[model samples]
Target: MPVPRNSKTTGSKQLRPGKAGAVENARPEKEESCQAKRSPSSPQGAPKKRSAFGDLTNAHKNQAGLRKKDATKAGPRKAQKGTAALGVLKNNEINLKKATRKTPPDEASAEPKLVPKNDPVLEEPAPVQAPAIEDIDKEQLGDAYASAEYAKEIFNYMKEREEKFLLPNYMEKQYDISRDMRAILVDWMVEVQENFELNHETLYLAVKLVDHYLVEVVSMRDKLQLIGSTAILIASKFEERCPPCVDDFLYICDDAYKREELIAMEMSILRTLKFDINIPIPYRFLRRFAKLLPLPWSQCAHASMETLTLARFICEMTLPEYDYVQESASKLAASCLLLALKMKSLGGWSPTLEYYSGYSSHELHPLVKRLNFLLTYQHDDKLKAVRTKYSHRVFFEVAKSAPMDMLKLEVALKS
Candidate 1:
């Protein structure tokens, strides 16, 4: 016979039917009562016992959820570590915030640890570099009208084209028109420019046309006025928004030349120059070089305007003079600006001007001396158009401004 085990349903022991037939001991009543008190009040059956594999699966799911939650908490800490010192400072600020929220309202908040600038753990960041003084065009990059991107290229192209248009002592080739006559014509052209409110570029281009045409074609002295009028007419057409008609130019000449003659002369001038009349003018160059002035002084802005006006007056004086015809427009403009700066007690030729103008102070010294001489003593009493026009208050009376002392100018050149 088989031995019998205790019966869970009856809570009693069962005896084996073999030899001796001993009875099994019964469970204590106290243990039974304890189990009864621990049992659930609902009529649900007991839970099924889980296997080892099932327990492992449940543990893996719980671990996956816990890992996701931990990664969510550490998101900001990873970002803080990526930023180096700035990241550390931000992390400290976050910790201080957390500590403040956790602290009781009655207690004082924890003081934040301030990092010193010279600390090895958190040093100051490197300073940003300053903009170059010579690169003035970069500041105007925001201004569409400035054309800052193309400004350097345009001026460089102009300089290169200047070699092609360089003039020689063309008067030696002319038989009829004299230098004095040319001066008178230029003076009259200036007057016309003032009278008709023509652009300064128009006046300069007109003069260039007259010179270039005079160099190539020799004409009778009476036809000189016709050439001047025709040259200005072409320039007006090239530069003016509403250029004066041929009749208007003929009228300016007191009807000395007929409209047909003026129109013919215009074709002649244009054809002689091959219709490429984009001559670089000293006025344009002077304006460009004058922008290098007013070097960081509070009052230098107004002084720069005066200095520029003085330079302009000096440049205009050379327009009528026959000697300066061989000089390049850029050189003449640079020299005039340098001389003006000296006269105004401003600084000498700086690296910024030299770099932009492409002329050293030594190279400009001779031209500067000659321009100064012209400003002081070479004024033509007969041709007073430039002087009289600049002496007005509108031009800041720069024409009336006295020249610098010769010794002082010499000293400035050396120093």
Candidate 2:
């Protein structure tokens, strides 16, 4: 009466629960068995074994708790973000308010004001004064003549060289032309000068060239007008910015001479002069002397201009007088300027003028008398060109001014 195999299997399966309970009660014994097995395979100093499943379980629990704490902090973080956005908006509003504030128009347009504590109003800076001529330092004044430097030496040398250009003989004796003929030529040249609006320097230079040519080369009296015309043409080319062409010069001369003859005369004059046309004339020295006068600073420019015009008139008068040819241009200029000042009742020649001009009152007095004689007595019908030219108001009516008396001139010169 043995049991069936199937029944036996079912009975063993039912006893498994009891077996599991017993294994649980024998845990220390199982651990000891496992240690024994591990000890055999491991080295003697190996660490004791840990429960890996227990450590994994504790790590999972800690992770879950940390996730809960992060969820709890999320509300406060959102509140802080909202507050920071509000602060940024408030700062933008403040900036807008500052930008909209009104600025005063005057303050906006004006430069930044620098207000002093004692004086609120801004004062203008005082004007600087020029030094008086008497108090001016010689070195600081930088006057080319007063400095007594190389300019003086060069000028003296030039004076010596210019003296060679003077024509000592009569224009009529040198050439076949009379003094009246020379005066007529000069008068025509003046009209030509006025027509061309040429400078005074050009007029003076033309006259000088004509005189020099007459002295050097003897020409027939019939060709005198051609000589004057050619001299003016040469002078125009030398001095003017837009010089009249040969055709224009011919027209001014009423086409008196042919172009070939005029050209031939120009060549002859230039050849005879050796092209030395740089003759010193009184006009330049007159201008320089007028500027050197120590007039009142306020009136210096106007006074100098008036004096210069009168001096120029006087110099032009000297051009027609053959006797004046012996005097140097510098001496004539000094005398003319001195006479002009005396006539205008300005101070006479001073030491300063003497120092700069290298001529004293005594030296210029005789020349002054000679100039006076020419200005007064030499104005006959034939020699009235310069007087008529200077009588116009454009020349400041210099010819009409009372002639300087001899006694008063002497007194002023001595003073």
Candidate 3:
């Protein structure tokens, strides 16, 4: 046996108890103890606690904490991937909201568009403003004709027919105008209407014929009102039933026009149109063709009126035989509306189709396109100087949509 310490060894001699007594004697004095390893020392002057048995302790405990840092390093690649995935999911949710939301029109708060409000296609297209000089020889004024003398000669010839000759007895029931003057008035009226942005169709046609007849007999500046009035009168006879009388014409002048002057001019114009009262205008042709094309009546009416406005600009418009008007009414009307709406700086023809057709404007595109092509051919560059093209004699004296309440005048001796 190993040699024992003197008093310390003797004190440790309490051993070898019975098995049951030994188990009871082996119970711990503390509740629970940690398995501690080597322990670090506390700082100087820090309080330290000792074990009850004075044994070196092996237990350790950790306290959660964040260290003071200069900068937090970014996470590992896997951690970064998880963050990116979260961001992507957030972005997807945002995209879904955008896809489903209904955005209002940019100008949805504005008032309803009157003209075609979509596809506003306009360039700075200044209309070819024909000269204010009514007497420009068609050859010099418009490209359609040449030879100023021919233009003047034609004017005189037409004037002579109205002034010196009487219509044949059989054709007395017809309305007539200076043949050459007729087309000139129509063409110029169209041009003027375009410039002024006035959309009165009846006014254009009436002014055209009036202006023409005024030039036909004599451009007597003093008799201008009479010419304008007489031209309107003839147009009234053609365009409206129960045509206005001298008194009504005077009232329309707002007392500025005179009765005797209009009466005298009326007689002169009557002689020129040869009293063949049944001169048909494009308005009639428009109604017939608009029906033929199955265009909406109101829309077609607007179109025909537009054609009549354009007629004021067409040189040949004055001589509209029934066949000519029938052949080109659709194209002419559409061109007028297009040019008019374009000048107004509104959207293209679709709005018109929507308003008039009760459907989207797209449906009328094919017809509108075809009509555009047809009008394009009508503008022949070679005819710019034509004698009859430049003069204003063929159209009305004043363009005002003729009044509906005109009184019928009995120009001929009552049978």
Candidate 4:
């Protein structure tokens, strides 16, 4: 309370509760508080959770920006999934998010809501009654066999026409597989089939494309084989996994199918398919429907191979679109095995189809049986001649001549 040096020291510099410097500093703090305390309606920088009725336009935009930030913060994989899901949500008509809101039934409806708790209406619809397979015969299938038979005829004619005339013309037009080089190209295609386990569809498509390219483009002679081999290589890649590498194929051919051949063929074929390698094959569909019917593995494998064999037949033909691979496969399998049965004069139903076929544990499809019989009578010698013409073809080889085991498996399943 006492000034040590002089009383003037205390009076001259008297302290003040509110100094100008303090007031100036306080102004910024007050402004910050006011800024903090403003309106509740103003959106903070934080992202609001997306809701059912959120503004789609703005929501998408904000979500997109947040995604970029999150991607950088989280990782790339999440960002990719988010982007894919975004596309699916925007365009996926069938997979839209389920509506959360549920309406009360009593509010409105033409029909009564709850068939009273104890009423007959409350009873569940009588258990669905599907007839046993024995009761549901092929006659009930109505012309299914006929359709398959007709389809086969069309495909057979198509192959013959495509190969003898159309293929050469196509080669002349598309890839210029000159007459001399055509043989080599054909050989390479066969090699590809053996090497890649490629179905007939891919093989034929590649061959057709190569032929078309040769006919249309006037490439140098030295590069002709390359064009064919490469077409097959890439076609394999598009159609299957574990496709051989350019170098591996080069080695496989003992360097006959060289690197240049592969590279050239890739471009030539890509151009021919118009870059659309998404052509459908029958295997996928056969698997799906076969699951519903319950055919055995022996039958399935036989069916698979037979269907594969049919792909060869179809590849050589031009009657129907290749997109019908599944339909053709199913029919071919049912038919080929059916024929095998008729030749042996096998008969009777199996439990597998005693339910469906009503025959003892032995019969396969009747139509197939009829087809076999008809084929035997119709092509006693013609089969050899047709095979002779198409023997050198890439996708025309028959994998198995007899499918007895598959038939037995089919019969066993019925039991």
Off by over 4 Å in 2: 1-154
* Candidate 1 per-residue C-alpha lDDT over 302-322 given as tens digits, one digit per residue, 9 for 90 to 100: 555667778878888888888
TM-scores for all candidates: the values are 0.67, 0.62, 0.28, 0.35
lDDT of 3 by residue, 1-415 (tens): 0112233234332222111100011011011001000113211231233322332543332111122121233346668898887787687997646534644455443436534345345322333332322232332332222333354454334334333322122212223434333344344433322222222334435543553344345463344444655666665555432344565456434466567777777777778766644332333323222222223434444443333333333313322212232223333444334433332233344432333223233443443343333334434332332223323222221122221111111111010
By descending lDDT, how would the candidates be arranged?
Answer: 1, 2, 4, 3
Please tell me which predicted candidate would have the highest lDDT against the true structure: 1
Q: Which candidate is the best by TM-score?
A: 1
| Count of backbone collisions in candidate 1 | 0
3-110: candidate 4 lDDT, tens digit per residue: 122333333432111111111111122222222112233222322333233344677888899999987877878788989977886796555553112334444353
Question: Residue 264 CA error for candidate 1 (Å)?
Answer: 0.3
Better of 1 and 2 by TM-score: 1
- For residues 1-415, write the lDDT of model 2, one tens digit per residue: 1122235343322211101001111112222222112113322332233322224357888889999999989989999998987787688997646544655567655545555544534433332232222322233233332332344554566578676876767564654677777777787777666545566667888988988888877777778889888998898778765567787666656557789988988899999999988787776566546656657535455565567678878888877666776678788889998888877778777766776578988899888887777776666685566777778766667888778676766777677
Higher-scoring candidate on lDDT, 1 or 4: 1
Q: What is the lDDT of residue 152 in candidate 1?
A: 74
When 1 and 3 are scored with TM-score, the better candidate is: 1
Total clashing residue pairs per candidate?
Answer: 0, 0, 62, 40
